[model samples]
Target: MDQLAAMATFVRAVDAGSLSAAARAIPSSLTSVSRQISALELHFGTRLLLRTTRQLALTEDGRIFYERARSVLGEMKEIEEALAGNRREPSGRLRVSAPALMGRLLIAPLLGDFLRTFPSLSVDLLLVDRNVDLIEEDVHLALRVGRVADSQLVMRKLGEVQMIHCASPDYLARRGEPQTPSDLAQHDCLVFSDAPGVATWRFGRDAGSGQRVRISGRLWVNSLDALATAADSGTGIVRVPSWQVERQLAEGRLRRLLREHEPAPAPLHALYQPSRLGSAKIRAFVDFLVERWRGSDPLGR
Candidate 1:
């Protein structure tokens, strides 16, 4: 059995979740894929996957090996691409992840230009609100907004995204506009439960310098799109990233409120694992995005 081939097959099977799915991905038969995984397990003298009737789960050892295998495969691919004298051209699969709303409104538009420039490059964009493990998921780059906790990953600050408190004109007319942060308590506030333990809306800098306003609301949502929708329908006032509500504000669907008392702008970042940073494909894609955003008004500052 070819150990390298078996390892590659095993990694694919683990990622695809099933032998049949992995076979289909590699354009091979299920039997062949199964044999490849079995050979890998035999070679290593341990069962890598715990196979059940419904699903395939990884063993602890399998999980560790899977991560290492992915890194090795990525490095191998990079080496082959470099040796082939195709390093100058961005020709490879690039996996990217970003927030759903921001991905659609901001990043999606830029992809067309990127693809045009590098015709041989293929991109898989994962639009999710929740944070994903970049190395574990094999993602090349991730566009993140707000504060990032992972200091190990390489991060490049693209720009700052301002948080704005906005409400529909109709809602303001009926409920009246709030003059200060303290007045928000009396109004129905649309809550975004994306961040945990946010029972009270913390406004301004610190505990003393900033005022912690405990606001109540009937609507609670996890997605920015949903929260923005509720605010547009005049459900209540919502504090969201300015870019998310910029279009609505321009169309008069939403109006900014308490501009002077708004929280500090959250910095947007492009994060990637250190291992993949040197790869031509990864560098080219990130540089392209940075350049594109640098020229735009939203990311320019």
Candidate 2:
């Protein structure tokens, strides 16, 4: 089988939604398109697509193969363009990793527009809560939330997310609002982290490296949404990233607190392996993110 040609036909057929559509797009006979796809399935010893008279759907194996093949083809096109000295429009596959909740809430929504801006570019986004090794995960780029201590990879600063101090009006009504970080010591505080210990909330200070006060609460939740819900129900004061609780603050489900003592916002960064240093697609995406956050106030500042 002509492997590359077969893969190309398979991809086109999938994209065009039918063998006849693929045939028209490839400017080839329907028989030839059909033959190529069959060759691919035979070569792989697996059925790539389940076809009905009206539509096509990929099998589990087929979807995986499609993504890999698309990435491979995209890279080949980029290599050909570079060899021919074509104008660089930032083409090819970009594998990006980001934290799960943050990625969905922030990064994923911007991707449709990003892809529209650079049509030749394809993204493979991996959303996982844990930090991914760029080289191990085969990621070309990553959007990381919070403080980054990974000095090994190339990093770009992409602004920050504010830590919003908030509580319910009823909570304050029952237990008076804390005026300062130190005052939080006397009130119930809902800790967002997973461990049981003295929880620390920081406050920005004019003359020093800010203030840290230890507080204890009746409830602590690992999930951000759950933490917000607990705070909304007047459980206790919760400090969370502004992005997660912004809706509650806006709708008055949760009321902001300690504006004067708000801690310095946690930073966001784009990280990539050293091998990806010269990649145009990675550069374009990072620049796009930096611009997207510039003076846009995602932190609800």
Candidate 3:
């Protein structure tokens, strides 16, 4: 059996969702599609799919093989492109994963311009609040906020965003503004959480001088929008990414506070699975991001 052809056929089946669908896409017969899948299963010595008339599901081994197959196929294509001297222009479907809030706020706005600049390229942006496996999710690149440490993937520094403390005019009016990070203990704070509650807030110019102030709050919420809105409604003061409240700060809905003690700016990064043969699209996008974010800090820390 021709291994590459078989792999291509198996990939098509997974992409198209069924044998018939795959056959239609390949303009080959359903029998041929079945034969390729059978060849793959036999070669791998494992069941690739559990298929019935109505549905198709990949087995555990099948799922693993599929992800590897995709990366292998992509690398092969990139190699071919490089040999053909078509590598200068990025021309393919580039899949990206990013945080929901940052993607929607900072990255999404840049998509149209990037596409326009590279007419041959297409993009798919997947935005979620959690970490995603690039290979498992078929993501070509991930634009992330915060410090990421991963040995398996390649990382590139982009820029940083300030994490600032802010409060509404009414909240400050009622409870009085904090004179120092130490003073936060006397006031209601809008806590951000992944768990049940927050017990402290950290502040400093650097790691050596940093301090965490023990604090209490009436509201403990998980959502960024909700946290900002809570602060805006005079519910409580919050520590949030400065970029998140650009409009609120400008319009005086939320006033910046404790600037002298705000923590060091969080770094932004572009991450991707390592490849011997790199993706032009990934390089182009990363370069675009670096170009856009240079000498800018959420529009101050």
Candidate 4:
């Protein structure tokens, strides 16, 4: 048996979850795929798969080998691409994740141009507000808006996202505007329900000293867009990323509040696993984003 070919076949079978699925993926007969896996197991002197009529499970050793096989196969592909002088032409499905609001407002709009630039490539963009594990989720890249707390992942700073507190003109007219961060206690502040005390807004200097205000409100919603909408409709003061409230602020629907005490701007970054650097697709996509946001003041600062 060709050992490397068998290893590649085994990795494909593991990813496909079934011999039949693997055969279909490779456009080969089921017998051929099964034979490859059998040869691979025989070569290793261990059963890699616990096969049943309805399911396939990995044995303990199979799991370890599978991980190594994947890494090896990926490196081999990268080496081949580099040797073939195809490193500049990235081709494959690229999976990217980003915060919901930022993805919808900014990244989503750029997908068209990016795809047009690289017709050989495809993108799967996941937009979610919560943090995602890049390795576990199999994401090639992620756009994060806050501090990157993970030490395991590699990060490249793309831009800064400044947070802002805003209220609708009508609401400010009725309830009066807050003159200080300390005065937020007396006003209705919309916040996320998931974040118990998100209404407790913080403001500080770049030097690290900051003050936190415990705020409460009549509207407690989970969606940032919803909070911005409620604020635009005169519900209450809503603190959010500046980009989210840019249109409202420009249209005079919402007014920026407490500019003298806004918190330090959070950094935006493109995060990925170190292993992803081997993929030309990931490198190209990240480079495109970095160029787009670099000096554009993405935070609307």
- Best candidate, TM-score: 3
Model 4: per-residue Cα lDDT over 259-299, one tens digit each: 99999888888887765555678778888887876677566
Model 3 — which ten-residue stretch has the worst lDDT? 292-301
Off by over 4 Å in 1: 1-6, 9-45, 49-64, 79-87, 194-198, 205-208, 299-301
TM-score of 4: 0.82
**1-301 per-residue lDDT for model 1 (tens digits):** 9877888988898888888888899989989988988888888888789987557999988989899898778867866665655437878798999988889888899889899998989999999988898867878789898889999888988788877799999999999999999898789888878654436776774446887788776677888889999999989899888877778999999999998787767788889876655666777777887787776665423
Worst 10 residues of 2 by lDDT: 77-86
Candidates 1 and 3 compared: the better one by TM-score is 3
TM-score to native of every candidate shown:
0.78, 0.66, 0.85, 0.82
lDDT string, candidate 3, 1-301, tens digits: 9889889888888998898998999889999989989998999899999998855799999988888898788777766654655436888888999887789888899899999999989999998888888877778888777778777878887777788989999999999999888888788888877676557777896867799888777788877889999999999889888889989999999999998888887777788877623667787888887777665544244
Assess each prediction's global lDDT (C-alpha) against the native.
0.83, 0.81, 0.83, 0.82
| Model 2, span 114-147: residue lDDT tens | 9999999999989886788664455778878766
Question: Residue 290, candidate 1: how far off, in angstroms?
Answer: 2.3
The TM-score of candidate 3 is 0.85
Each model's Cα RMSD: 5.0, 7.3, 2.9, 3.6
